[model samples]
Target: MRNWLKIVIFLSICLPLSGTADEKSGDHSKYVRHVEQGFSAIFRGDNQTAISEFETALAIEPDHSEILHYLGMAYAQEQFWNKAADSYQRSLALMPDNIEALYSLGVVYFKLDKWADAVPVLEQVVELSPHHARGQEMLGKTLLKLRRYGDAAPALMEALTLKPQAAGTYQELGTAYLNLKEYTKAIENFQKALAFGPGRYAEPHYGLGMAYLRLGDREKSRAEMQIYQQLQKEFAEYERLARLTRAEPNNLEAWSGLASLLMSQKNYPEAVQVFQRCIELAPNNANFHHGLSRTFMALNYPKHAAEAAEKAVQLMPDQSILYNTLGSAYAMQGKRREALVTFQKAIELDSEQPYYHLNVSKLYQSFGNQKLAQEHYRAYEHLLSEQKAKQK
Candidate 1:
């Protein structure tokens, strides 16, 4: 399942407005100002500022459903689940059919692991908005947590229909089938999940392995189990790194390790956040900026990558790797001349770096300079061979 917090944050930001305070009311100007400020804070990820602004808004009009809902979102962002739930409950009390409030409340419950409490709220969400895919998905996950396998299967199946490529839902549905002793269906759903997520999802492989074991297919089960175990090891390492960062928020090494692991997992969004946090702790750290640049590149935000890479280069102008990263970002933005110049600077700084030579070679190739391309390519090959030989 997707992290409940992430789901709540996304929904809070994207869901259509249920309603707003009456602009024609006497206190409308004051209320709107505070509400606007609250939303601005929310967008900036300043939960404290958001909470304060929303409280001010509520003081003006305590019965406003929309402001209460916004307050819930701010509280949820800060992981203050109890406060979030209270705000959502208040919002729903004023506007009973507020689907977003209902869903957010259910998500808060799910995050709190109050699975039974989550069920009816999520059930109401799906009932009110039958086409709400995330609502169905959350309801199914809540049911799965409660071990209501038969109920979970249908809800998850509906979610899969709405979101055909949700690998997590497929994995959960496979689990439902597995526990129901429908081994073939379990294997089928798990295989579909693996096909969609490949190496990123381990749980499906474990489910598949269990299904195969039930069917007495030892070889297939062994292969799936091996993959599952390997992925589990990698996931364990990631979790350990994540825990270290949480335990020592000011520890540069811990944050760096977690950011690197997130990048390797291709989770560029979270990696960007981690890199930003690292930068916050050590603003002058060029490596954090370089990592942020790489993450932005992975996210296909070439302009952002260029900006971060430029910061990295400014902080550590002598580093060949920073120049290389800047060059790559420029190349992504179609700044061919800038890319070539930056790449050449990288080579000048460290002539023996084979990857730098390879980057220049590719750029030259793109510019139809075959002679220079081949020259740089030959240098890359020779340097790479020398490095390998030295290692051997």
Candidate 2:
């Protein structure tokens, strides 16, 4: 259950499965004593010591599968996956039918990118309990990642039927539909996902927003974006921005932060309006022009983006990002020559941004300028390699 729920549900990160020995939580008395020790240690913040106590119980009752499982779970709570996986594996060895161990091991394998190992174990779980919603759901997601969309569909569908209320299952089904280009079905599932997992979930709504945008439902896309905005706001953030701007009404950074928050909330029209107001508040401010230009782009008013971009460039001739923004606006308007010139100017201004290079490469590729595109691709690759080397 943890494995099936953790992988697809948490997206590469697994939440801890620390079993509680709470007296009111379980029935096994002797097992409960050790579990309580582990729980107490964990709660008291002596996790490593708590882990040892759980390990000792497993040793005293060498055949106690439950003790082994909880010990593994304790290790997992501390993010010691290798130890956790080993404990789960030992539990499985003792009790081959241990679903918890199987599930947890699956998550560990997935986290380690041991997809091959994960697939067989999860498949076994699904086969053992064909109607288990979580098992089917996890197998479906794993299959999707393996690009077996056709095979993934039936399992995901079955999982949805059993767990109709699991928003994440719907999201996965939507992803499967998306990969298959089953747009109508994808949208349907996505909407269901929104109903289930919409609040505070970044990816589901981001996916739905993109899907609506693809279907030319701009208003729906904006609506989904509004939820993302609502979830992202914190009291601290609002207070921080307010303080940062209190003494600097004309501060470009502060104004940009406020503008960004408003934009995320899908107040695009207001964001555009506020940015225009900001530009007037500080007419010669390059950032205000930049902020206004982005707002116009979000509003899908490309012509306005172009004008704002032009103003930003005029004010900050050395800012490559501003030129890139303007170039995008020009490209959207099909002003090919202007886009090209501005893109070139942006590269001359800032030679390090791979995106700037990639943008120009894409434009050239669209125009069938294979030679120019290849040059830029090579440059981008070189930069990427250098960055990776630095990280090492």
lDDT of 1 by residue, 120-187 (tens): 99999999999999999999999999999999999999999999998889999999999999999999
Put down candidate 2 lDDT per residue, 1-392, tens digits, no spaces: 88987667775443333233353244345555876787798788787878888876665456778778877877887888899889889889989887767877877777666767887888777777777787788778888878888878888999988888999888898888877877678888887887887344655666677678778899998987776565655435745766776777777677667777767666677678668767777899898889888888888899999999999999999999999999999998999788988998999998887777887888899899999999998888888788788889
Each model's backbone clash number = 0, 0
The per-residue C-alpha lDDT of model 2 at residue 299 equals 82
Q: How high is the CA lDDT of each candidate model? A: 0.93, 0.80
Top-lDDT candidate index: 1
How far in Å is the alpha carbon of 213 misplaced in model 1? 2.7
